[model samples]
Target: MNANELTIAEARDALAGGELSAVDLTMACLTAIDAGTPLNAFVHATPEIALDQARAADARRGADAGALNGIPLGIKDLFCTKGVASQAASNILKGFKPEYESTVTSKLFEAGAVMLGKLNMDEFAMGSSNETSCYGDAVNPWKVDDRRLTPGGSSGGSAAAVAADLCLGATGTDTGGSIRQPAAFTGIVGIKPTYGRVSRWGIVAFASSLDQAGPMTKSVRDAAILLGAMAGHDPKDSTSADIPVPDFEAALTGDIRGKKIGIPREYRMDGMPAEIEALWARGREMLADAGAEIVDISLPHTKYALPAYYVIAPAEASSNLARYDGVRYGHRARLGQGDGIVDMYEKTRAEGFGKEVQRRVMIGTYVLSAGFYDAYYNRARKVRALIKRDFDEAFAAGVDAILTPATPSSAFGLGEMAEADPVAMYLNDVFTVTVNLAGLPGISVPVGLDAKGLPLGLQLIGRPWDEAGLLNHAHVLERAAGFVEKPRKWW
Candidate 1:
C-alpha cells in the first residue's frame, strides 16, 4: 500500500495493527514531498527529524503507543519548532530557529506524531491568496481548464500539502479564515478551534486575539484526531483556557439529531454566486435530513465584520511584530556608514516586511495613532464586540450551530487578481472572518464540486468551546456529502 495515501486515522490503525511501520510511512511522505516540489507546499523539508521521530514512534509500538502513534504530519512555519526554521514564510526570520518547541507542536510530538516539514503560508499570515509568500505562491493541485489555481491563503501550503497526500495532516494557524479558506479551496477539512482552545504560546503572532492554530486534514475524522492532540491549555499562553481537552475523535458519533443549526440571512449577500447559494441550501437539507432543525437567524452586525477585522487584526499585528525591528533577533539590516539606530530600524523593517505586511503595519500604526485611535481602532473594537454579541445572542436563542458557504466560490487561478484591487482578495474571507471575530469554533468540510470540478466547502460555526459538537456536525456533513474526489496529479 502507498503509505503517503493513508489518512491519519488509517495510518494509526495500520501502525497499531502492525500493517505498517512509522519509518516507511515517513519515508513515503518525504519522497512525495520531494517529488511534489512543484506544488511548493513545504518550504523547509526536515527528513532527518522526521525519520528520527518515526523510528522512535516505531519503537513505542505495543501497549505504550499513544493515540497519534506513528502518524506523520506537516507543521506550518508559524509554529516555533525547536531547532527547525520557524519563519512565518517571511525573509524577516531568515535562518532563525527557536530554542523551545511551541506548546501545540510539543504536545503533538509527545503524542507520537512526526513532522514532515514547515509548510508555506502568506508572509506573516497576511493576504487571502497564497501569492504574498516570500517563497512564492503554493500552486493548488486542482486546476480548471488546465490553468493552475491558488490553494487559498495563509494556510494554503497546509491545505495543499494535505490534499495532495504529501502528508496525512498539517497544522494551520487561522487569523481570520486562514485555515478554513484554504481548506475550502483544497477540498479538505480545516478547523479553527475557539480562541484559547489551542494555545498560541509559540505560533508566530499575526493578530494576537484572532490567531489560532488548528488542524487541516484529508477528512473530518482526521481533523478530529489531530485536534485532540493539538488542543490543550498551556500555562505559557495566558489566554489559553484552563479547560480539559476532550477526545475530539471519539465525539464523532454522527449524531447531530435535534440540533438547532442556524442559517444566517446576512451570509446571503448580494451577488453571491448561484453555486454557493445552492451549496448552502443543500447543506441545510442534509442537516435537516439527519434530524437537525434548520432555523433562519440574523447577525445584524455581520456587514461590519470585514472592516472591523482589518482594523483590529492589523492593530494587533503592528504591536506583535514590533519585535522584528532589528533589535533582539530575526533579520537585521546592514548599517550604512555612521547610520543612527533610527535609520537601522527603518531600513530593517523596510527590507524585512513584504508589501502586504507592510501595508497592514502602517494601517495598524495609523489607526492606533493618537488622533485616530478612537476614530478607527477603538470603533473597530466596538464593532467587533457587537459582532460577538450577535453570535452570543444567536447561541443564547438555542442555536446549536450556524451553517454557511465557506467561500464565495471555488478555487481561482493563481495571480487571477494580482492586477486587480487588493480588496477583491480580502473579500474572499467574507464568510469566514466573523467566526474569528466572535471567537467561535468553525470547520470547513468539502461538500460538493463546482461546475469547473473544483471543491466547494460548507462551514459550520459552533458555540465557544464546543469544538467536539462542531466536529460531530462536520463529520455528519462530510459523510452526507461523500466528497471523496482527489485532485488529479497534474503537479
Candidate 2:
C-alpha cells in the first residue's frame, strides 16, 4: 500500500518503527492532494506549513512522541489555522486568515499532527450538500457511470479526502448531520462527540449549541486515535466541557457482549427506501450476533425533529453570523458615492453570501422576528427540549446505546435535488438531527452497500460523554459488517 493510504494507527506504528519518515509521508499526501484537484476536497493547500511540521516531528522522534506524531490531516475550512485561510467555504471571509489557531487545531499540532490544508465545506455549514460551497461541490470519489455524487456536507471535503486516501484523516464539524452523513455517504468512520466534548474556540460558528467537531477517518480505530488527539477541555470556549477526556483508543475492547442497543421504531419513516430498511435490519442482526440485546424503543418526537432542527439551527446561525457584517474584518462591499454604512452592510452580505446561506439567514431572521418569535423560535425550542427528554428517558431506562440508519438514502447524484424544494434536501438529516438536539455522542459505521453498490451506514448514539462506549459498539458493528469496499478512483 502507498504511504498516503495508511490509517492514523498504521502510520503511527510505521513512524515509531522507523519504517516511514514524516517527510516522505507528507510528500505522499501532498502528491495525492495535487492529483485530487478534480474532487476539490481541499480549498487551500498549505504544503510549506505541513513540511515544516513534518521536519520538526522527524527531529523530535522518540518514545515520548505524541499519539499523532508525524500524522498528516486535513483541517476543515471552518477552523482558524493561524496564517491559513479559514473561510468556512463562504465568500464573505474570502482571503481572510486568522492570527491564531483554533483550540482543536492547536491540540492536534501539540500532539504532532501535520496539516495538509483547509478542506471545503458548505458555506457557513448551512447546507446538507457541498454544492453550497463557493469553491464548487467537493465531489465524491465514488461515482456511478458518468454521474458524480455528493460526498455530503458540511464536512463533505473531509469525508472525500479521508475516503479517497488524500489524507490519513481529517477534522469535521457536525451541526445537524454533517460529519456522520458524509462519513456514511463516503464509507468512512465519522464521530461527533458530545456537544461540549470538543472545544469550539477557534471554529467558525454555525449553530452554537449544536455544532461539535470530530474526526473523519478510514476505520473505527482511526477515528478513536484522531479523536484522542483532538479532544480535551478548553478554557477558551465557554461551552467546552470541564470533564476529563478518557483514553478512547483503550476503550475499543471489541467486546460488546450484554450491551443493550435500542432500535427506535420511530426511525422507520414512511416512504423510506427498501434498501435502507434492509440495511437497518442487517445492522440489528449484526449487533445481536455480537451479543448485544436489540430492544424496541419509542422516541415519539422523532417526527418533529427535522422541523425543530431547521428552526433552531437557523435561529442560532442568524445570531452567531450577525458578527459578519461588513464592519470588523473580511469582505466589505465598496459603497457608492453617497452610500452610508447601512448600504455597505446590505450590499456586502448580498454579494458575499450564496443563495442557500441567504435563504437560511432569511428564514432565521423571520423565525426570530418580534412578531413570530414565540410562534416559531420559542415553539421550536420547546420541541427541542422534548426531543432531548426522549433520549434521556431511553437512557434512563437502561439503554446502552441507540441504533439508527445514518441517512435516509445513499448519496444521490450532484444537482439531483438542487432544483427541487429546499425541504427535500433538508429531509436528508431526518435520522441525525435528533442526536444533535440531544447533545449526545454519535458515530456512523459503514454496514453495507445499497442495490446500486453505494455504501450505507448505521448510526450509534451514546449517552453524553460516552464516546468510548459508543465507539466500541460501532467497532463491533464494523467488524461484523466487514465493509471493505472503496470508491473506484474515478477522479
Candidate 3:
C-alpha cells in the first residue's frame, strides 16, 4: 500500500522494518491533504511540524522509540495542540493558538506521532451534520451522482480525512455522537470511551460532562492502537478517571466465544429505513456467527435520550461558552458610538458564533434560567439518570455489549437537513446520544453498504471502562463483515 493508504499498524511495521521512513509517510499524508482540499477535511496544515516530528522519530529509531513512533495523525481542531490554531471550527476562536497542548495530543506526541494539522469540525462541536462549521461543511468523500454528502459531525473532517486516505487516523471528541456518527457516515471506525477514559484538559469544551476524546481510524485494530495511545487518566482534569491504561491493541484477539450482545428493542424506532434495519440484522448475524449470543433487550428510556440530551448538552454548553465573551482571548467587535462593554459583548458574539451555536446557546441559557431550570434542565437530568440506569440494568443481567445501528441512515447530502427544521438535523444522533448520556463506551463499525452505495455502520455500546473488550468484539464483527470498500475519490 502507498504511505497514505497504510493503516497505523501497517505503517508501524514498515517503519520498523526500514521499508519506509517517517518523513516519507508524513509527506505522503501532507500531499494527500493538500490534494483533498475539495473535501475540506483539514482546516489547517502543519507540514513543518509534521516533518520535524518525523525526523525526530527517525532519529529515535533503535533507541527509545515509542509504539506510535513515526506515525502521522490528524488532530481534530477541538484538541488544543500548542502553537496550532485550535478553533473547534468556530470563528470566535479564529487565530486563537493555544499555548499548551491537550493531554491527549501531548500523549500521542510523546508516543512519537506526527501532527498533520487541525481537522475541521462543527462550530463548538454543536451540530450533527458539520454544517455549523465556520470553515464550511466538510464534504464526505463518499458521494452519489453530483450530490456531495455530509461526513457527519462534529468530527466530520476527521471522518472525511480518514475515509479519503488523507490521514491514516485522527483524534475526535464525542459529545452527543459527534465522533461515532461521523465515523458511521464516512465508513470508518470511531470509538468514544467512557466519559473519563481520556482526559478533557485543554480540549475546547462543548458540554464538559458529556465530552470524551477517542480515535477515528481506518480499521478496528487501528482504532485499538490509537486508543491505547490516547486513553488514560490525567491529574489536570478532575473529571478524568484514575484508572490504569491497558494495551488495547493486544486485547484484540477477535474471539468472543460466549459474549452476550444485547439488541435493544427501543432502538427499533418507527420509520427506520429498511437499509439500516438490514444492516443491523447483518451485523447481528455476523456477531452471532462469531459465537456471540444475541439477546433481546429493552432500554425503556431510550425515547427520551434525544430530548434530554438536547436540553442537558446545550445547558452545559451555555455555561462553558460564557468564557468567550470577547473580553478575553478571541475575536472582539469594533466599538461604535454609544457602544460600551455590553454592546461589544453582544456584537462580538453575534458576529463570532454561527447560527446553530447561537441557537444552542440561547436554548441552554433559557433552560438554565431560574424560571425554566426546574422544568427543563432538572427534568432532563432525571431522565438522563434513568437512561444510565437502563443500561446499568442491562449490563447487570450479563449483557457484555449492546448492538444497534450507528446512525438512523447513511450519509445524506450536505445542507439537506440543515435547510429544514434544526430538530431534523438533531435526529441524526438518535441512535448515538444515548451512549453519551449514559457515559458508556460506544464504537461505530462499517458493516455494509446502503442502496445509494454509501456505507452503513453498526454501533456496539459497551460497559464503562471496558473498551478493551468492546474493541475486541468490534474486531470480530469487523472481520466477519469484511467491508473494504473505499470512496471513489471525487476530490
Supply the TM-score for candidate 3.
0.99
Model 3: residues >4 Å from true position, as ranges? none
lDDT of 1 at 394: 96
Q: How many collisions per candidate?
A: 0, 0, 0
Model 3 worst lDDT window (10 residues): 61-70
lDDT per residue for candidate 2 within 1-491, as digits (tens), equals: 89999989999999999999999999999999999999999999999999999999999899778889999999999999998899999989988999999999999999999999999999998777798999999999988778889999989999999999999999999999999999999999999999999999999999999999999999999999989988989998999989998999999999988999999999998999999999899999999999999999999999999999999998898888888888888999999999998898899999999999888888999999999999999999999999999999999999999999999999989899976899999999999999999999999999988888899999999999999999999999999999999988877
Instruction: For each candidate in the order shown, give its overall lDDT on alpha carbons.
Output: 0.93, 0.94, 0.93
- TM-score for predicted model 2 compared with the true structure: 0.99
Provide the lDDT at 423 for model 3.
Answer: 90
lDDT of 3 by residue, 1-491 (tens): 67999999999999999999999999999999989999999999999999999999999986589889999999999999899899989889988998999999999999999999999999999988888899998999998779888999999999999999998899999998999999999999999999999999999999998999999999999999999998888999999999998999999998899999999999999999999898888888988988999999999999999999999999999999999989879899889998998899899999999999899999999999989999999999999999999999999999999999999989999868998999999999999999999999999999989888999999999999999999999999999999999999777
Those runs of model 2 whose alpha carbons end farther than 4 Å from true positions after fitting are: none
* Count of clashes in candidate 1: 0
Q: Whose lDDT is greatest here?
A: 2
Q: How big is the positional error of residue 357 in model 1, measured in Å on the Cα after superposition? A: 0.4
